[model samples]
Target: MLMTGGEGRMARIHCKITPLSVYLVVLAMYSTLMMLACLENEELNRVAREQKQKTAAPLQDDMAIVRDRRSQHGKWLRTVDDFFKRMGTLETTCSKMVSLGGTYCRRALDNNKVVCLDEDVTLKSTNCTVYSFGIGADTTFDDQMSHYGCDVFMFDPTVNQETIVSTNLKNERFHLLGLDIFRYNRTHMNEYPDGKKENVTGEFDTYDNIRRRLGHESRHVHYLKMDIENTEWRVLPNLVEGGRLEGVRQLAIEIHTMDIITAPAHQVLPLLRQYWQVLERLTRLGFLRAWYRPNLVLETLYYVPGENRTIATCFEVLYLRRGPVY
Candidate 1:
C-alpha cells in the first residue's frame, strides 16, 4: 500500500483563495455599504432642514414687526378692527354691505368711520379668490397672501428670475410662472391710454399649458390672478363654463374695459352686457363681490384705419369668488 511521492501529494493537498482576491471582495463590500449609509444620512438631513425652516418661519415673524408703511396705522386700526370685526362677523354683515352702498364699507368699523382707501385699504382679509392680470401694478394682494400661510401662484410674464427668486414667500409653497395666457390668436395687442404701449414678447399659452409647465399637480387653484388684458373676455368664460370654475378659489383680473364713447356704437353696450352677465353669473354662483379697483391709468393702442395705432384706458376688476376654499 506504500505510494509514490506524486500520489501521496495528490491525496493530502489543500487549496485557499489568494489574500489579494479576498481583500478586493471585502473592499468592494465596504465601499458599497459606506455609499448607502452616506446616501441615507444625506436624505435624512435634507428632510430635517426643510421641516425646521418651515416651522421656524412663524416664530421669526412673530418676534419682530415688519417695518411697513401702514404698520403704525395698521396697529392702531387693528385694535379698533378687532372689536368691531368680531361684532359684525363677515357672514352676517356681508349681506348688509351689498345694499348699504358706499357707506357700508365704512359700516364694518365705526358708526360713520368708513375706511378711507387711497390705495384700496379694504382692511379685511380676503378669503375669496383674486385674478390679478397686470405686472407693474403693485400687488398688495400677493404681499398680504404671502404674509398669511396661504399658497400664492404669482404670474409675472416679465420673466425676471431675481424678482421671482428673492421673494419673501417660501420656496416650496410659492410658485411664480412667466407665461402669458391668451385666447387662440396669431397676433396680440395691448392698449393703454395712460400707460406705455408695450408689446408682450413671450409665446402665448393656454390655461392647461400653463398648469403643466408649472409642474404643480394641485387639483384646485386657490387664487387665480390674471392681469391678462382684453383677452379675459374671451378666455375667462371658457374656464368658468368648462368645469374649471370649481378649481379656482379667487380670481382678480385687471380687466381692460374700453370706454363706451371710444368703442364702436354697436359694440359698447353689448360688451358691457357681456361683462355684466359674467359678473351676474358668478354672483349667482355665490361670488357676491365684484370689486372695481382703479389701480392704474392706462392708454389704449389700436390700428384705427389711417392712424395705424389706437389707444384706451386699462382698468382693474377684482373678481372675488366667494366661499372659503372650494
Candidate 2:
C-alpha cells in the first residue's frame, strides 16, 4: 500500500511539471515571433524611407538652390512645378472632347485680336493663315475667318485622288496654295490611300519656300494652324530649327495618330508626349504664354507592307500666343 501511494505522488509531480514545460515552450515561441515581426517592420520602414527620400530629393535640392540665390519668389518655383505636374495629368483629356463643355474655358483668348472657340464677333478684323492638307468648303475658316477682318491663307499641297482643286478656293484675301514649311524645298507629298484618280499637285514645300512665296516680304504670321496628318513629327523640327517659326502670334493645330503610327522621327507615343514637346519648343521661342488641348480626333494610320492601311485619328490643340490683354 505504501508503494502504491508513492507511485501516486510521482504521477502528481509529473503532471505539474508537464504543464510548466508547455508554458515555457509557448512563451519562447511567442518571443521569437515578436522578434521576427519587429525585424519585418524595420525592413519595411527602411524601404519606405528610401522611396520617400528618392521622391523628395529633387524638390529639396531646388529649395537649397533657391536659398542660395534667386530672381523669382520662392512660391513661384513651387507653383510652376505644381502647375506642370498637374498639367501632365492631362495626357488624354482631349481624346474624347465632343464640344465646348459648359464649364469650358475657351475665353482664354479674350482681350486679344485672336479669339478661340465661341469667339466674340464684335472686333472682327485680322489675317488668318491655316496650314492643313486641305480645307474643304464645309470648314468655317473661309467665311468667318475673312469676315473677322483677316486675310486668310490656306496653305497645302492638295493631294487627293480626285477634284482636290474643287476644294481649292480663293478670295480677295482668302487664298489657297499648295505649299508647306520645309528645308531647302526638300519637301514632297505621299500618295493618297484612296486612289490616284483625284490626286492634286505638289502639296509639300520648304519653310523657306513657304515664307518666300506667301510672306509678301513680311516674315510675320498673324495666325497659323497646321494639320498635316502625322508629319508634324518630321516637319516641326525643321520649323523650329529655322528663325522663321517665330512669325506667328496665334496657333492651333491637329496632331494626328501615334498609336498605330510609329513616327520614326518623333518616336512612338500612344499619347501626346512628342506633340507637347514640339509645342514646348515653340513656346520657348516666345510663341505661347499658355496653351490648352481641348479636342481629339478619332483617326489613325496603319501601314502593312504593300497593303497600306490608314485610319482616321488625330488630336487637336489651340494655343494663344503672347500679346497684350487689349
Candidate 3:
C-alpha cells in the first residue's frame, strides 16, 4: 500500500503501543504524582510545628511563673456585690445592727450596739460574749456593748500596763488581754515603752492558742470585731482553715489596701496574696458580707504636696454566718 511519511510514522507508533504498555505508563505517572504529593504534605506539617513552637509561652520553672492575675481594686469592688447579696437574708441575724463608734469603728450596719437587739438569735445579748481583736484606746463600742449586758474581751499589744490597770475607769465588763491576735506566734517590740525604752517585748497570739489559754474551747462568740492593720488577711484564713469561726455569729473587719499601706515595690507578693486568701476563705466558710463601709478619710499623700481628692484605702466589712452556729 502506498503511504505518506506521516502515515508511516503513525503506523510505527501504533505498532509499538500495546494495552499492557499503556497501563504501565499510566501507573508510573500516578506513582510519581503520589510521591511528590506526600513530600509536599510532610514539609508543610514540619513548617507548621516549628511555627507553633516558636509562638508558644516561655519555658520556665513553675515557681517563677506563679502569680495572682486579679487586681486588688477589682476584688474590693466585688465585695460590694457580695454585701448586697448577703444582707438582711438571715432572719435570726440582726438587721438593725449598726456601727457604734465613730468613723473608725464603722461596720456594715450603723445601729447603736447598746440599743440594737435581735431576739431571733440562739444567744441573747444578755448572755452573749464579744471578742474585740484591736482597740487603739477607743472604748465607745465596748462601753456600749458592756452596758447592754455582753461581756467584751479586748486584746491589744499596744495598750500599756497603766491603761490595763485602769480597767475600772474604762469598763468593768471589758477584759483586756496583753497578747495580740496574729496569724503566727511571734514577738514584737513595743514602739513606745513605759520607761522611754523603744523596744519592749510583746507576744502575738494565735486563734487556737488563744482559745486554749482563755479556756473558751467550747464557747460560742456572739460578735467578733477586728482592726489589726493588715493582719486580718492572714488571720481570717487561718481561722477559716482551723474551723475556729464555726461559732462566730457576726464579724466586723477592717480591710486595708496594700497599695496605700504597703511599702513601695517591696515584698508585695505575700501582701497581695492576703486579699485573695481572705476572699476565697470567706466564700468557703459560708460567710456572707452583710455590710461594707469605706473609710475615705486619711488618704495617703506626699509630705509637702497632695490632692484631697484621693480617698482612704481602708474599709469596714461586716459578715454574717449563714449556717447553724455550733
The candidate maximizing lDDT is 3
What digit string (tens of lDDT, one per residue) describes model 1 on residues 110-193? 111111111121223444333333443344455555565445565554433444455564444333333344533233344555
What TM-score would you give candidate 3 relative to the actual structure?
0.55
Single out the weakest 10-residue window by summed lDDT for candidate 3: 58-67
Write down the TM-score of every candidate.
0.44, 0.46, 0.55
Off by over 4 Å in 3: 1-94, 103-123, 165-200, 260-274, 299-311, 323-326
RMSD of 2: 19.0
How many clashing pairs in candidate 1? 34
TM-score of 1: 0.44
- The best candidate in terms of TM-score: 3
Q: Relative to the true structure, how large is the alpha-carbon lDDT of every model?
A: 0.44, 0.45, 0.55
Greater lDDT among 1 and 2 belongs to 2
The true-versus-predicted C-alpha distance at residue 93 of model 2, in Å, is 16
lDDT of candidate 3 over 1-326, digit per residue (tens): 43457545523234577899999999999999999999999999999866543222111231122112223432432332232232223222244564465433334333223222333333466578888877755656776666667777777766555655554334433343433445333344455435564343445778777767778889877788887877776577667776778777677777676453444534333444455556646644655555565555455321212434433456667666653221
How many backbone clashes does every candidate have?
A: 34, 25, 5
The clash tally of candidate 2 reads 25
Residue 3 displacement in candidate 1 (angstroms): 99
